[model samples]
Target: MSGTAEDATDATTKRQRRGNTRQRIQDVALELFAEQGYEKTSLREIAERLDVTKAALYYHFKTKEDILVGLSQDLQRPIDELIEWAGTQPRTLDTKREILRRYSVALADVAPLFRFMQENQAAVRELSVGESFKDRMIRLIDTIKEPDAALTDQVRCTSALFTMHAGMFALRDVEGDPEEKRQAVLEVAIDLVTQAHAGAQSPGKPPKSS
Candidate 1:
């Protein structure tokens, strides 16, 4: 199992490196943009920071907008994939829960990229990257939520997903082992999923009297 996982990771790493020079340039460009202001960063500076010639960076990206598009694509492909995969899965509670778990893992893998996006909203908006990302998020939400689900249960499921993200950010401030914090956050998410599922089948049903 470990071998298979490692092989998959290696393959993913290699794939990320190959045919994704544009993506790498975008990643580095976003880093520079975030460090300095987007308005202050130049393509030449990006090249300098990356130790590459301006012409080389220009080969992959004609302009900073091009770089932003590349970065959005890199951050988006997996979520698009997840949305596609989820659309074909059974809409059972188990499937919904699995969707949350898988999403949490995917979010963790791209946390740094997410941070860059959050911090550079104006640039992301300028490049229209935010639109594509938001569209996919809506799709993901639709996948986990049933038609006509009660508002409270929907809130629980939504809160569950956000908690995982918050945990990733918040745990940094809390003093404890990282793994333990993750597990605790995961437990809360799982609990919320369970609560959401309990009411999912009956749109307006309240909890049974004890």
Candidate 2:
């Protein structure tokens, strides 16, 4: 039993070390991709920045695109989980507000990846991860907006998500606490969704005389 326990501990340590190395590679690759255009950044550069041999990097990721795809997959897990959790909840104004709050947290967690995506739009568009992310956004929008909502209300719901994205990028250089800026952005997004939900719940105004 002691020998078995030691073997398990060794395996766990190896797995952790491997995970750390993969994370380091992903971080360095994202930095390089953002500094230079994704098309121009090479695997060798990522390996060099990581202070690892090309072969060592290759053991984890065969190509630059692989590293990018890995990063996208890692960052997307929370958003995907949020969408799943939202599906299980009742559709209500409170639910929508909670969705925005949770999404803001997820976006903060992956801000660097999102910034890279914003700067490298064309390159990201060509990748599979880009398409996957777009699909996730559409699903998230559906969760917040009523199916029969007015066109304007639908726009408000859609805009709520973008507001969060734009807020992060726009406020990065501005002087303020990061969490405060995030809360301010979240407030605006929740307000937009609340307005849309209220509009859907309220009676329509009577037609005006010509």
Best by TM-score: 2
For model 2, what is the error of residue 72's alpha carbon versus the real structure, in angstroms, after optimal superposition?
1.5
TM-score of each: 0.77, 0.92
TM-score of 2: 0.92
- lDDT against the true structure, each candidate: 0.77, 0.90
> Model 2, which residues run further than 4 Å from truth?
206-210
Among all windows of ten consecutive residues in candidate 2, which has the lowest summed lDDT?
201-210
lDDT of 1 by residue, 110-168 (tens): 76667667666776766677788877777787887777777877887778877887788
Candidate 1: lDDT of 13? 94
- Each candidate's root-mean-square deviation in Å? 7.5, 2.7
After TM-score superposition, the amount by which residue 163's alpha carbon in candidate 1 deviates from its true location, in angstroms, is: 2.4
RMSD (CA, angstroms), candidate 1: 7.5
For residues 1-210, write the lDDT of model 2, one tens digit per residue.
999999999999999999999999999998988899799999888888988999999999998888889999866898889899999999988899999999999889888999899888899999988898999999999999999888878999999999999999999999999999999999999988988898788639422222
The CA-based lDDT of model 1 is what?
0.77
- Between which residue pairs do clashes occur in model 2? none
